[model samples]
Each structure stands twice: as C-alpha cells, then as structure tokens.
Target: MIGSGIGAPEKYRKVVVEKLGYVTGLQLSLRENLFDAAQNFDDLAKVSSELRLLASCLIKFAKDLRLLSSGPEAGFPYRE
Candidate 1:
C-alpha cells in the first residue's frame, strides 16, 4: 500500500503541470485578442459598434458586482 501511494504525488504533479500549460495557452489567447481589438479598428462604424458592446459589457459587470456586494458580508469586500 505504501509503495502504491508513492506514485500519487507524481500523478498529481503531472496533472498540475498539464493544467498550467493549458492556463498559459489561454492567457496567450486572451492577450492576442486584446492586441487584435486594440490594433484592428479600421472601420468607423465597426469601431462604434465594438465600443458600444464593450460599454454594455462593462456596465453589466458593474451591476453584477453591485448586486453581489449588496450585504455587508455577502460577497467580495473591496476597499478603496
């Protein structure tokens, strides 16, 4: 039983390493998306539409945060 348990840590380490690789890939993809959004605004109408969509997303996120932090100890406590 002790010998069998010896491989558990190795297996867990392998899984963690694999997950870190996946997270790194996702981070790179997000960075690429940000770069594209920042640099590729050629059309004025498209830029206006994208800006409106971004504003709406930000507004919704703010509303969600407000709703979550309604009570004193309900959600995340942010300090300014």
Candidate 2:
C-alpha cells in the first residue's frame, strides 16, 4: 500500500539501493587500500605492480557503479 503509484517493482528498487551501498563501501575500501599500497610501495617494491593493477581495477568498478547510480530521474527511477 505504501508504494501504490508508478510501475517499477519495489524489489528492484531495493536491489539498486543495496547495490549503491555496496559500491560505496567498495570505493572507500579501495581508497584505503590504494593509500596503504602507496605508503608501502618502497617496502613492497616487487609487488607494487600487482597492487597498482588491483587498485586500478577497483577504481574502474567504482566509477562504473557511480555512473549507473547517476540521474535518478533518468536511469532506473525509484520511489521511496
């Protein structure tokens, strides 16, 4: 009865919100990890390459999620 208007399924809206939260967390974690990697780059010289690549991948994923979450009125508009 709460969401008795527009079409889109409530479950789908919940899924999108959940995904946004997850992506936010991932972005924060990736930022922290990237910082740590930079700080210890000298100590972990040989493994820096892998760490950099991993950080790059995480950043890309976060960016993609951010784009997906953009324009509430346009993409997957959900009512609370």
Candidate 3:
C-alpha cells in the first residue's frame, strides 16, 4: 500500500516496515498483559484511544494523498 499509494522509496519502505514490526511487537506485548486483572483498565483504555487517533491520522493522510494524486496530468503520475 505504501509503495503503490504513496510512491514510497525503498528507504522509506524499509523504515515503515521496521516501524510496523515494532508496532506488532508492542501489540503482542499488550495482548499478553491484557488479561491481567491487576492491570489498570483506565490506562489501557487511554492507550487504545491514542492508537485509534494514530490510525485516524494515518487513514486521513493516505486518503488525502490519494485525492491529491488523482486525475491525469494533475498530480503524481503513479504507475499502476
């Protein structure tokens, strides 16, 4: 998606891939602790809320970029 959608260079793609791996590891760690009854539910909720905000921003940025690049001879000439 990053490559096709944003015309991301190889270096940028590598950075994105590394970040995604880090996020996946974090999610796995969170999942492992999610069932602990002693954990603070409010703090978990706040973390979830922040993740949602991050997702929203990423989606909006991708959508906006796609829109800006749409139409021939108007923006980026993304090859299909």
User: Which one is best on lDDT?
Assistant: 3
lDDT of 3 by residue, 1-80 (tens): 21142354657656665787797774321123323534546866999999999999999999999898787877667689
Clashing pairs in 3: none
* Candidate 1 overall lDDT versus native: 0.61
TM-score list, all predictions? 0.38, 0.34, 0.43
lDDT of each: 0.61, 0.61, 0.63
RMSD of each: 17.6, 23.9, 18.1
Models sorted by TM-score, best on top: 3, 1, 2
- 1-80, model 2: which lDDT tens digit per residue? 12322465657655655786797774321222434555555655758888999999999999898778767666556778
**Could you say which candidate leads in TM-score?**
3
**Which lDDT value does model 1 have at 50?**
93
- Candidate 3 worst ten-residue window by lDDT: 26-35
TM-score of 3: 0.43
Q: List candidate 3 segments past 4 Å from native.
A: 1-39, 73-80
Ranking by lDDT: 3, 1, 2
By lDDT, the better pick of 1 and 3 is 3
User: How does residue 70 of candidate 2 score in lDDT?
Assistant: 68
